[model samples]
Target chain A: MTKPNEFAPAWQVAEAIRSGDVPAEDVTRAALDRIAALDPKVNAFTDVTAERALTEARQVDADRAAGKTLGPLAGVPMAAKNLFDITGISTRAGSKINRELPPAEEDGELLKRLSAAGAILLGGLNMGEYAYDFTGENDHDGACRNPHDTARMAGGSSSGSGAAVAAGLVSLALGSDTNGSIRVPSSFCGTFGLKPTYGRLTRYGTFPFCDSLDHLGPFARSVRDLALAYDVMQGPDPRDHACANRPAEPALPSLNEGISDLRIAVLGGYFSTDGMPEAAAALAPVAKALDADKTIDADGIDAGRAAAFIITNCESSRLHLPNLRARADDFDQDTRDRFLAGAMLPASWYVRALQVRHWYREMFAKLFETVDILLAPATPFPAPLIGQRTIEIRGKEMLTRPNIGLFTQPISAIGLPVCAVPVFSGEMPLGVQVIGAPWREDLCLRVAGHLEKEGVAVAQAPSGF
Target chain B: MTMSDDDFDSEAFIRTMAPSLGLSLDEERVAGVSVFLSIAKGMADILDAAPVPENSLELASVFDAGQTAQQAKAE
Candidate 1:
């Protein structure tokens, strides 16, 4: 019989539940018990749906008794970021200002689909206020702590999604990435997170950060779980016009296909600069594991990052115009100031920046014609101390809040699929993004799987979990 | 209100120009927004310096012929 307290992968848990060796209820109960015991230190959850989780697990057990076929993630415990609506909660979105809005009419589309795939909702996870933050510190909810070292930061805005998985509170959770919400948190907390291609997964029922750039996806401890969660949650939706009208290409069947004919390289030039020694050191083993040789120069990345910053400012500011005017006092100070500044930007700058985005995307298109995958450090450095503000990279100090997304922003700006795979030094865990061409998540996952198999990249659960 | 010259004190700029623009901002809010704008303006300066080609303003819609081929073959 499988041990209830064991930290098993989602795939293993599903198989255990299927074989009736460990009942789904016992597994769910163990996860809930862990959350209750350790969440005070980690602050990974804003809410824990104990009743809902037990109910879902019972149904899975009942189905197995009746000889019904189980889904790929049957009986797997999961949670969603607070930005996702959970039917009866006022999608607080990690902000004081949004708490009073009426409860969401229904669960977000992603949750509904995951439930159908037999993943139970443990609850909603904590996030940065209004999802505008890169650092995991939240003004409304407490700061989501790194599982490895409680005093260190868990990068956000998908703060709790990463910490929970790393702490073994739950095996899977969902988070959104506008710039680097999913990837940054995944890096800091030492977990695997997938930011699927923009327009790949439907974004219906999630809080909007920047509609043009918003992408919803999953986080987990293993690459297989990342691909499994992504494959199940994807498809077309009329409500999210940005979601492409394409059939779901399930990644499970090809996840273990290996990186046989794949051509991989590390991003040079801009990606090489501003990295901490430890952060830069994490990439060497991954390169050796996949035999990645060629160096690709991604020119104009700085301008792309700046353009993304402007677009985020312009779009998010407009979205919050009504709320900002009425109750700016209710918002986190960091979120409030950025929105107000964006509102004041010259219209010409926003438009010109969007045009520049087009130029940059065109450049990537031509560049992707040759390379199959590109690897880059997910964050410039490992998780900073919880309250530390400035990062000294090569003698120059930069603000910690915005520069945390330095490496992630440029890739996200153009809507590419990136899988953040955890790598480690002596104690702290770091991550490198296995990047793919737009809609080529298969290649990225293949490379990530290769690294995981080689022990070069793997999610190390925080000690004492 | 605007960058009339180079004498750009963030606090003074918002304080002097906010009234004409009909925005009644508290001192804290104005101070916050000013600092945020100053940082963003620094980023915009880097972008504004990068030379973009003429007539390349249309949004680039991505198309993957290779994926299309792979899909068709699978079918």
Candidate 2:
């Protein structure tokens, strides 16, 4: 068995299991041991599926012994943010309101696909309540801590997904992004995360926050592991109307193709503005590494964010209207209020935002015509303190929650595939958001792989876990 | 069109609308609603400034069918 401090990438673990260098049960036990030793301090998981993990691991061993074929991810331990339904587990979505709901009948589509690929579900991780907030601070469940600094926020609604992967408790974890959930946590935790284009993955069993903006993606310790998980998870689902019927693009091949001579653009104007100086500074190396030749202006990013917020609120309110009317007090105070406000949105405003969404998407298409990918900061800064409600930016105090997505919201509005590549400036972790045209996750991941190869923004697991 | 504060008691309006959409909110939820309202209202104003032509709506059909199919299976 690998020692507690010894770490192996997900691919390495899978290969070891496949070659019988280490038994699948031993790998499962090692991950369980790591979680037992570190989760108390990190607080990344809401539940640990110890019994189920062992069973799955043993199944893999049995299959291998019988000379049966195993999936690529067979025996690799991972977790999903609590928003995803695991068979027999209630998907709380990090809220107090869903505690009374019955356990799910089957695994969410994403989970089913991952399991089919041989990933062992370790347990459910924590997240922002109803995915309404950017900070991982949960009033019901204690906030998930950044592995780098326990007192700092991990960024959410995929908070625990980032925390678990970064702290080495799990090799891979799934996170849902609407706005910046997947990217933000990855940025804060110094892990690699991918937010595939909207409707790029199935949302059949995942709890909905805003149907239009929601995206499910992977968080992993390495870009390759993230690519592997994403490869297995990319496909259409009949149950999800938003899911487009498309053939999967082979992302792993593009990763090896390299990104030299690719026409990459560094997003200027809106993305470069309204963020921390460190965030802009972190992009310098990536710009130099990619030899980025153009500075593309994202003309309506601010406006896009506004429209996204409006649409998200209006749709979210519609989704929760019944609960808001009958049992409003049961919700996490922050999420409840956000939903109520969304409920109050005028129909005209929602319509206007939708109309603007069309315009914004066109604007992105025009930009992509000249560039393969656009690079910008993922979150404005590294994770702030868990309880920090306000932050000073350019001599002005801003609310942490709403402003955190200044760089993320606009890109998501157009449903572009984005890879959040973690960059380190000293001890704090920041990320560069690399965006590709719709259904161009291959291009996004390829550019991310290039960045990783050039040592621009390599993933770094949090120390002292 | 300009909407005066009097036209909607933004807080009360949101509270009433919350339950219809499967969201449950209470007194504390009022604050978040207010923030969202403020942000949404500001954004709606921006979109209204440059009204998009109806012809621009044709772009929604540009999605990748192959990618959509792969995503559906993964879902």
Candidate 3:
């Protein structure tokens, strides 16, 4: 029997429930009990849907007893970043602005699908306000501290989702990635996070930051679990215009295919030049595992990053223009200032950015003809301390918020599938980002799994969980 | 497209543009806007140094056409 306190993968938990070795209700009870005892210190959940989770677990138990069909995720407890709408709960979106908004009449499409698949909703988690900043330091709601070391920051804006899963409070959780929201937290909190190809997962009812860049995905302790959750959440929704009108591809079956013949590349230049020795050091084993070839020049990367920033800021400003005009003071100083800067950008500049985006995408397409996946550091460095404004990297000082997404922003700009795998360097956690061509989530996961199997990266539950 | 350093603190320019753009700007809001404008102005200066292509066309519809092609393929 798996120890109650030990970190059990979601698939293992599901199998245990299926085999009747452990009842779904008993597992749910244990999870809730763990959350009840551990969450106050971890602050993983903003709301604990204890009553609803229990009621749902009971239904799963009743269904199992009747020999009814079980969903793939049957009776697993999961949470969404607070930005997602859970029927009857106001989607605060980690900001005070939406606090008084009416409760959602229906669960977001993602939530509804996950629930239909038999995953219990444990409630919404915390995030960076408006999902703007990368650091999980929420001023309105207290900053979600890193579970590994309380003084450190949980990478944002899916801070709580990352911390909760890493701390073993939940096996699976939903996180939105716009400029590495999911990947950063997963990297910092030491877990596996997947930012599927843009439009692969429906974004209906989820709050928008930058419609073009915003991607909804999963964070889990294992790559397989992330793939399982992603497979369930995928499929076109008529409601989301960005969603691709295609049938969902099976991600799990491909995970077992292995990466023997895959053409892998170590993204050099921009990816290799920056920050902490640990960040660069974490990539060596991944490169060796994949026998990755060096590619990607540094010249165009800055332009890619600049274009992504311009698009993110301009669209974000447009989204918040009304509130920014009405209640500018209500936002955190950082988010407010960034929005203000975005609002001042000229229309022509934004237009030029779009043109540049086209050129960059074509450039990536040319590169992908030779390589199936590109591996790079997820963040320039590991999670910095909360409230840190500047960090020293390679003897040069760098801004924390904007630079953290240096490697991540460029890839997301092109709408690639990226899985951030946490590599343990000594006591701290660092991550290597594996990016695949558009709609190649399975390839990304396969490569990530290869890294895990080869011991290139290891996932560990945060200490004192 | 070139802007001088003085453009960073163009409070009067921002105040005039704010209401025209439907933005709120009280004294405090003006101060915030000023700081932001400074950063934008700095970034804008850097961005302006690069020359634009004479035949540069807007790329918004690039994805739109590709999306249509993809949808047609799916059908």
lDDT of 3 by residue, B1-75 (tens): 576896445577677777766886677767776766675555455444534456867474245544453464455
Where's the lowest-lDDT run of ten residues in candidate 2 chain A? A1-10
DockQ: the better of candidates 1 and 2:
2
Better by DockQ, candidate 3 or 1: 3
Q: lDDT of each model, Cα atoms only?
A: 0.87, 0.84, 0.82
lDDT of 1 by residue, A1-465 (tens): 465354678988998899888888999998898899999999989988899899999999999999999888999999999999998889999988888999889999999999999999999999999899988898888899999999999999999999999999998999999999999999999999999998999888999999889999999988898888888888887677578879998877788899878888899988884437867788878887888888888789998898889989989988887787777778887688888788777777787778778888888888888888999999888999998899887568988998899899999999999999999965788889999998898878888888899899989867878
Encode model 3's per-residue lDDT on A1-465: one tens digit a residue: 543343788887777676666778888888888888987776768888888889999998898899988888887879989999988888988898888899888889998888888888888898999899788988788898889987888988999999999988888999999889988998888999999998899898888899878999998898888888888888988678788878999799989788988988788887774546878778877788788756666356766677778888889998898888888889987788778768867787788777777777788888889889888889888889989999977678977887788778888987899999999875779788999999999999998888888887778877788
Please give the clash total of every predicted structure, in order.
Answer: 0, 48, 0
Each candidate's DockQ score against the native complex?
A: 0.29, 0.39, 0.32
Instruction: Kindly give the stretch of ten consecutive residues in candidate 3 chain A with the minimal lDDT sum.
Output: A1-10
Measure candidate 3: CA RMSD: 3.0
Candidate 1 deviant stretches above 4 angstroms: A273-275, B1-22, B60-75
Give the number of the best model, judged by DockQ. Answer: 2
lDDT of 1 at A159: 97
Name the top lDDT candidate.
1
Instruction: Say which docking band candidate 2 falls in.
Output: acceptable
Ranking by DockQ: 2, 3, 1
